[model samples]
Target: MLILLNILSGVALLVWGTHIVRTGILRVFGAELRRVLGRSANSRLRAFGAGLCVTSLVQSSNATAVLASSFAAQGLLLLAPGLAIMLGADVGTALMARVLTFDLSWLSPILLLGGVVLFLTCKQNRAGQIGRAVIGLGLILLALHLIVEAAQPVMQGEGIKVLFGTLTGDSMLDTLVGAAFAMLSYSSLAAILLTATLAASGVISLKVAVCLVVGANLGSGFLAAIGTLGQNAAGRRLALGSLFFKLAGALLVLPFAPYIARGLSFLIANPRESVVTFHLLYNTLRCLASMPLIDAVARLCHRMLPDRADANPELRPLYLDPGALSTPTLALANAAREALRIGDIIRTMLDNVLELMRTNNAEQARATIRLDDDVDQLYTAVKIYLARISREQLDEADSRRWTDIITLTINLEHAGDIVERVVTNIQEKKILHRLQFSPAGLGELEDLHARVVANLQLGLSVFLNSDLKSAERLLAEKERFRDLERSYSYLHLDRLAGQSQRSLETSALHLDIISDLKRLNSLFCSTAYPVLDAAGALRDTRLRRRVLDATYGKDAA
Candidate 1:
């Protein structure tokens, strides 16, 4: 029971440890990664390099592979580049395996302590991400220690030797076993480590052990299969493509098992050499088999996972394609599209909300509420798209720009949320009391709305054109909106004292509406910040902070 518990505990730790590392790396450079990958054109060689470099930095090719699957799922990356990246990620894994071979115990504890402190104390930025990266690296080293210790007993036990022998004795059976085994860990790294240990123990022939490793490649695709569940047509196709790649690799290599064996045989005297040879052979074979026919594989994935009966039809920016990181120009384009989409939704919401404020008709408010779904949906799509982007490969300039986008999107979403919330409040107040505002109060609202609408329009232009000049003008005007709201806020309270009870209530309503408008302008200004940052604006911490605080609010959960 204790042994089983230890194994199970080790299993849980592996999952947690893997998550820690993946999330930490994402924190360190997620935005920049997405920018680069989302922007890459059809340059297969660049895609390969991106995959190798990104996974190498990330310290986990499985995470990178999962990222590619997400892009495919979102219709961002096609099969060719995705496959090329997969090949590169495999090569990247070999790099990580080599890193693991080094005894880094001396640094692991120090890294863990430092990472925990940074993660706890710092604000959200690249610095905070670095803390997470350190902690994840430390945890990974620790998890490896536990796993290696647990495997020691098996290495010495005759039962363990026999179990491994049975697995390797038959190529077909062992391949299935290996595939299942690797899939269980959700990591080819863990699978490779196990194989290396088995080899070092001399529990089985090199040929049999290599066969298990081969099987483990396909095993890693198990999660890809599970990912297809509850996803849309495009998402399913991407997931299926991942599975097919692994299975196809398995099928192709199984036939040439002898060739694979021959390659590893040359390294018998050197275990390190054997490990290297096995890694090279497995990835090389997998890549060669998949490369020329990547498009065909993509087409098959499409056919297998057909479109759903009632798919939500919209242009969603699947932003996280790692191939994009290889091309900053293309990433910039994708970001433009996503920003445009957000701007369009907010603009439309504002237009209808204005109608509600003017006419005071329930129908107008109903229409405004109806548009809320579109805003919410687009928000979800953009957030996920950004999350999928690979950040490690970005240059320093791009990294800053990418982080700015994250802030921009959050501001946009908050802007929309404020609009939605105030609109709902207005609708509720109207439905309950049916109070009409005085002409002066309505005029105040119209003036506030006009300024906010103007800011939104200018901010959209600033974002699309990368125009800091327009953005600066908009930022100044955004400050002027504060003056507008202050005038409105004071005027409404004074007038409410003379008005009838319903009129008094309407004045209060006008004050709230003007406040919300002020906030919307604040968000719009921040939204423009990313474009300015991308365009090389002088960084202003106070200006950025004031608006960001208004948008997220100090009390925001």
Candidate 2:
């Protein structure tokens, strides 16, 4: 009973350690990892390499899959490359298993002590995150050491001997047991390592261990499929494709299990070494062999789980998958992408309104209002989705990003409302009354509307990429828009004084429309302030000190 307790406790420790390592690495390098994966989408080999590197660094293939799945869900990556990444991740985990089996037992205590010190001293910074990873590594190694020691006594028990006697070299039964261990442990590396230890202790045959290792790989694929259940169609497709690869590989290799086991047993005398070596060889070959089939699998998965476009795509929160909330960085990325969609919806509304102003078309105006409804729904959904994310789990930078996404979505929502009102006012006052602006007034409004659209585009760019130069340009445009709006208002009043029929009849609508455009520009340009302020490039006051000085000099004169 005590031996069983130790083994179960060790498995629990291993799982907890893996969780710590994954979260710690993500917190420290999430954005960089994202960029790396994003840029590697040009080819399959590059994607594969990226997956291997990322999984090795984070110590979890599941983490890599989650990232790839999230990217697929958001249309940031394609299916073929995503599957290639999964294959690479499998090889990477196997490589780590091989590395961990080395003789580094002495470093565990030192890492634990140092990791604890750094984590306690700087719990909120990068240093502390690295320390957290180190502590997790130490715990994993300690757990492995404990599992091995505990298994030896358990192997000696009469009940264990009887149980082992029943399963004498049954490949199918052993394979199932191995998969169960992997699923229960939540770490295939831990499961495979424990299996190797069991084989080394003569508690299991080498042939059974081989079957178990293959089963562990199959179990990981099952785990990925389960994890992606809450994801969108694209994400589910990626998971399903990877699962297919695993299943195909497992089936193809099953018939050869006995022959391969016999051959490996002859090549390696030590049972533990043979099991680990077979694991390394099997995964590397299977993944490499399966790489070319990714495209085929992707097609099959897509056919199996076709994309279900929402009836109202714009009205829905497309990228805010609940599966991503467990990973704050991934969740934030999804939110940011969805915010861009909101920006696009507002852009469409503004474009429609501008056309209505020019053509006096009620249909155009109604379309703008409909788009506004989409904007409101999406904005509300995004805000609620972001609110559900646990802010305390985020680091400082992520927390700031969270706030930025909320602010941008709110501004876009307000801009949508403004555009709808502008369209309605134009349709009701100008189109209904058969009012037309003077030629000069018409040209000025067209130019202002064009400028507002450009600023909206720039604002979206600034919010999406946080580009400093673009942000500065946006701020400059805000000032220019204010001046232009003021001049247009003055010019319209001049025409009103002259009692020009066109300007007199449309005077109120002209001023109202121009003012609303100015307000829309203000909302669009607000995105730049946060970006610029974060970089220390933003002036505290909008009015330049030089302007204040010049105004004082004029007063003195």
Clashes of each: 18, 0
Per-model TM-score, in order, reads: 0.64, 0.90
Against the true structure, whose TM-score is highest? Answer: 2
The TM-score of predicted model 2 comes to 0.90
- The alpha-carbon RMSD values of the candidates against the true structure, listed in the order shown, are 8.8, 5.1
| Model 1: residues with Cα > 4 Å off, grouped in runs | 1-21, 73-75, 98-156, 228-230, 256-259, 308-343, 350-369, 376-451, 458-472, 475-557
Model 1 C-alpha lDDT per residue in residues 359-476, reported as the tens digit of each score: 6677777767766676667677666666665665454655555656666667677787888888887887754567676778878888888888888888777755667789779868
**Candidate 2 lDDT tens digits, 84-122:** 888989998888888777767788899899999998898
lDDT of each: 0.67, 0.83
C-alpha displacement of 205 in model 1, angstroms? 2.8
Candidate 2 runs further than 4 Å off: 162-170, 256-259, 465-470, 535-557
